[model samples]
Target chain A: MDISAFVLFWAAIFTSNILLTNFLGMCSYLSVSREVESSFGLGVAVVFVLTITAALNWLVYHYILVYFGIVYLQFIVFIIVIAAFVQLLELIIERYTPALYYTLGIFLPLITVNCAIFGVSLFLVIRNYNFLQSIAFGAGSGIGWLLAILMLAAIRRKLKEKMVPLGLQGVGISLIITGIMALAFVGFSGIVQIQ
Target chain B: MFTIIIKDVTVLSAIGSLLAIIMVIAQRRLSNYGDCKIDINGKRELVIKGGNSLLSSLSDKQIFLPSACGGRGSCAACKCKVISGGGPILPTEKPLLTKAELAAGDIRLACQVKVKSDIKIEIPAGIFNIRRFNATVTEIIDYTYDTKGITFKFADGEKIDFLAGQYVQLETKPYGKVKQGVIRAYSISSKPEINSSLQLIIRYVPEGICTTWVHQHLKLGDTVSLTGPYGDFFLRDTDADIIYVAGGSGKAPIKSMLEHLAVIGCKRKMTYFFGARTTKDLYLTDEMHAFEKVFPSFEYVPVLSHSEQGDGWTGKTGFVMPYFKDAIRDPKNTEAYLCGSPGMINAVTKALIEEGIPKDKIYYDSFG
Candidate 1:
C-alpha cells in the first residue's frame, strides 16, 4: 500500500507482467500475436479497455461493494462490469471511429472474456492499491501485455523463414518461444519485487 | 446472512441497472445513422433507415441478392457494384474480391458493405426477376431408391415464368432432427410451361440437413417455401446438333431443356446420354423414351457404368462419355449442354474435346 505509483508501474511492466509472468491471457496472446499489424491493433484495444475498466472497477469495489459489506461479490461484479464496459465501448467505437472498429475486428468484443483484463482489476483489489496506484498498475500491465505480444509477433514472422521441424511447427514452435520469453522475463525479478 | 445476501443482490442489481442505462443511451445516440438513400443502377432510388448491411437492406426492400453464406461474408456470392458511399473495402472482404474487383473500386460484398450514408450500387438485372413463393407439396414420386421427384403447386395460383434450365432455392422448415431452417439450391426440373407448379428431383445426401428433412420429414399437402429462378444454365439459341450428357440428379436441368424442346417440337438433331450405376439407379427412362418417340431426331441412350448380373439387356454399357465419344461423329457441328457432378462434366468435356468439339461450344453447370 505504501508503494509509489512509479515503482508499481515499472514492477507491473517488468517483474509482475500479466501475460509473461502470470499467463493470464494466453488465448488471444498466442492467436492474435501471429501478425505484427493485428497484434498492435489488438494490443491497443486491450490497453484501452483494461485501463478504463480497471479505474471503473476500482471505484465500484471500494465505494459500493466495500461500503455495502458485499466484498465477496467482487469477482462476479467485476466480470459483469468488464463485460458491459467492453460491449458499450465497442458500440461507441463502432459508431464513431469505424476504421478503428474494423481494425480490432472480432478481438474487440473478445476482450470481455479475456482473463488478463479481469486479472488487472482483481490484482488492484487484492493488493489494496489506492486509486492512482490501481490506474498505474492497469496501464502498466496493459503496456506489458502489448510489449510481450509485439515481441512474439516479430519473432514468429522471422520464424517463418527458418527450417522448423515438421512436428514442431505452428503453435508448437510458438509455445516454446513463449516459454523461453517467460524465462527471460523471470530475470527481472531481481530488479524489483511487487510484494 | 440473509441481510448480507439481500444487500449483495441490491448492490449488484443497482450496478447492473446503471450499466444497462448507459448502454441503452449510448446505443440510441450513437447508432442513429439517419435516413440514407440508395441509388440503384442510376435509375431507381430507395430511401431507407441507415446502419444495416447493403445485402439485408436490399432484401428487406424485396430486392433479392444471391447469398449462400447468409451474410457471413464466407461465400463471397453477394458481390455488387458499389458506385459510391460504400466507404473503404474491409479486410474481411479483401481476400474474397479479386485484384480487378478491388481496382475497379466498384465491387464490394453486399453483406459486408454497411449503409452508413447515401450510396449507389449496381446489381444484375436478372436479380430483379427473382421472387419468393409459398407452395404446397402436391406429390412426391420416388425417382430412385435415394432420389425423389417432389412437386409443389403455387398456393395462390401464381405462375413463375423462368427459363428452362434455371434453378430455385428450396427452403425446409426445421423438423425432427434439423434444428434450424435450411435453404438449398436445386435445379427446376419442371418445364416453364408448367407455370402454377414446379418440381425438383432431389437425391438424398447422407447427413445433409435440408436433404434429410425433405426425404424423411416432408409430407404431402405440407406448405413449403421456395425462392426462384436463379442460374444461367439453359439451352442457347443455335441450329447446331445438341449433345446432352447427364448423370444422377444432374438430369433436372437437362430434363427441363428437353421438355422445352419437346414442347416446341425442336427439329435439331439431339443425342441424350444418361448414366446410372445399375437398373434401379436409372429413372425417367420411359418418360425420356416417350420424348424420343414424339421427336424422331431426339435419341435417348442410357448407359450403365456397373450393370449387374440378371439385368435385362441395356442400350449402352459404360460411362456416358465413352458412349457419347463413339456415337457422335461430328462434334464440331454440335452444341453440347452438360449437367451433373463435376467429375462427370470434366470427364465428358475431355471426351467431347477429344472428339473434336470446340471447348467454348460446351456449356455446363457442375454441382458439388
Candidate 2:
C-alpha cells in the first residue's frame, strides 16, 4: 500500500504481468489462443473472473480469515469463493441475459480453477495492497493477460495462412511467441518494477 | 488449544456453508423455469419441467429422436424445426448448420435448444411413433463364428410397428463394473409385419459393450429394454429395380426389407450382392436361397474376397464393386440399398455411382 495505486496498476500491465512475467496461467492461454474470437471470449472471461475473485478473496481473507485468526484456511476458502461466485454468476446471467450467457458465460467455467485468478489474490496479499491498490492491480493484471492472449490469437490466425515447419506448429510456435513477448515486456521493467 | 481447533473448524464450516447456501438460493431463484409446454408439429403437446435441453425433455416423454452423439450437440442428427419460442441460434450450433438451414431461421438442434418456455417445434412425424418396450430373448442362433441372431419377444404382448429397414436402440444392463446400462442401435432383422417380436443380428466387436452383453451374457428368457423404429434406411415406394449390397452384420436391415418386399409381393426386379471374407463369414445362405424361390424377380450373388486356392468357392470373387455390371440389367433404372462398414459403403457408393446410379438413388446405412 506504500506505492501509489496508479503505479501498481501500470506495473502489473507492463513490468510484471501475471501471465507474461509470472506465467501462472498457461493452460487456457495456449489452448484458447488459436482463434481471435474464442480467445477474446476466454480472455474477457478470465479478466472478469480474475478481477472479481481478487476483490472477493481480499474481503473474505481480511473480514473472515483475519477476524477468525484462521489465515491458514485462506487457500481453500479463496478457491471456494471463486468457484461459487463464477457458478452463481453463470446461473444468474443465463437466466437474465441469454445472449451474454451463450457468449461470455460459456467461458466462465474454464476460469473457475484458473491459477491466474488465484495468483492475483495472492499477489494482492503478498504486496500488502490496500483496497484501491488491490482493485487496480487485479484489473491491470487482467488487461495485461487480455493483451497477451489477443496478440497470440491474432498472430496465430495470421500464421494459419503461412506455412510453419511440420514439427514446430500449433503449441510449439505459440510458446516461442510467448517467450519473445515476455522478453519484450522485460524492457518495460526499467520504467516500473512491482515485484 | 481445544478452543483454537473448534474456532478453526467452525470458521471453515461457516464460510463453506454460507457460500453453499448462497449458490443454492441463487440457483432456485434464477433457473426455475417451471413447467413448459412443447407443441411439436402442432400434433402433440408435452408438458415438462422446462430446464433441460429440448432433446432430453422430448426423450423424457419416450419420443426418441435420432442423435448420433447422444445429446452433446456434436451430431446435427437431432435437428428439428422450431416454429416459435426457439431463440436465436448460438455460436456453437452455427458452424454445424448449413447456410440454407441458417437462413430458414427455424431449424435448430434439439440438444442445443434449452426448454426455457413454451416452444413450438416440428420434428419428423416418425419420431412420434417411437416407443419404449421391454422384451425377452426367445432365441439365439449362431449366424457366423462372430455373429449371432437373437430373437426378442416384446413383453405384455406389445407390438412394435416399425418400417422394414428401421432400427431399434437395444439397451443392455450394466454388467461388471459398468454402473449404468447403455443403449446401442441395431437394425430389426425380422419382418416388420411381425410386430409382436423382432430379431437382431449382432456381431461380436472385440470390446463392444452391447455386443459383448448380447453374445456372452444374454440368455434365453432374459428380459431387456429397448426403444424402437429409429432410422430412415427403409425401402422407398418406387417400383424401380433394386440392388441390395450388404457385408458382415450389415445384412440385418436388408433382411428386414427383403422379407417385407416378399410379404408385400413387390414386383420390382431385385439383385442382392452379398460380400464376405470367406465361406465362414457368410450367413443366411439358406434363407437368401429360400427368398430366391419365393420371390420370382429376386436374384442372389454372393462374393468371396479371401477365397483360398481350393476352398470350393465358385462365385463372383473379390470386392462387390466389379460385379455391379453382371448383376444389373439396366443401371439407370436401378436403386441400390447398401448396408455395411464405412469402408464398404464408400466403395459400394462409388461403384454404384460409377455404374450410372444417381447418388440420390443410392440409400445406405453405414456402420457407426
DockQ of each candidate, alpha-carbon based: 0.61, 0.72
How much is the lDDT of residue B272 in candidate 1?
Answer: 90
Model 1 interface RMSD, one decimal: 1.5
lDDT of 2 at B222: 99
Where in model 1 is the C-alpha error above 4 Å?
A1-11, A33-37, A97-105, A151-171, A187-189, B1-8, B293-297, B313-319, B327-334, B346-360
Where model 2 places Cα greater than 4 Å from the true spot, the runs are A96-109, A161-169, B91-95
lDDT of all predictions, in order shown? Answer: 0.88, 0.87
User: What TM-score number comes out for model 2?
Assistant: 0.94
Candidate 2, residue A154: Cα displacement in angstroms equals 2.4
TM-score of each: 0.89, 0.94
Q: Model 1 Cα displacement at B192 (Å)?
A: 1.3
On a 0 to 1 DockQ scale, where is model 1?
Answer: 0.61
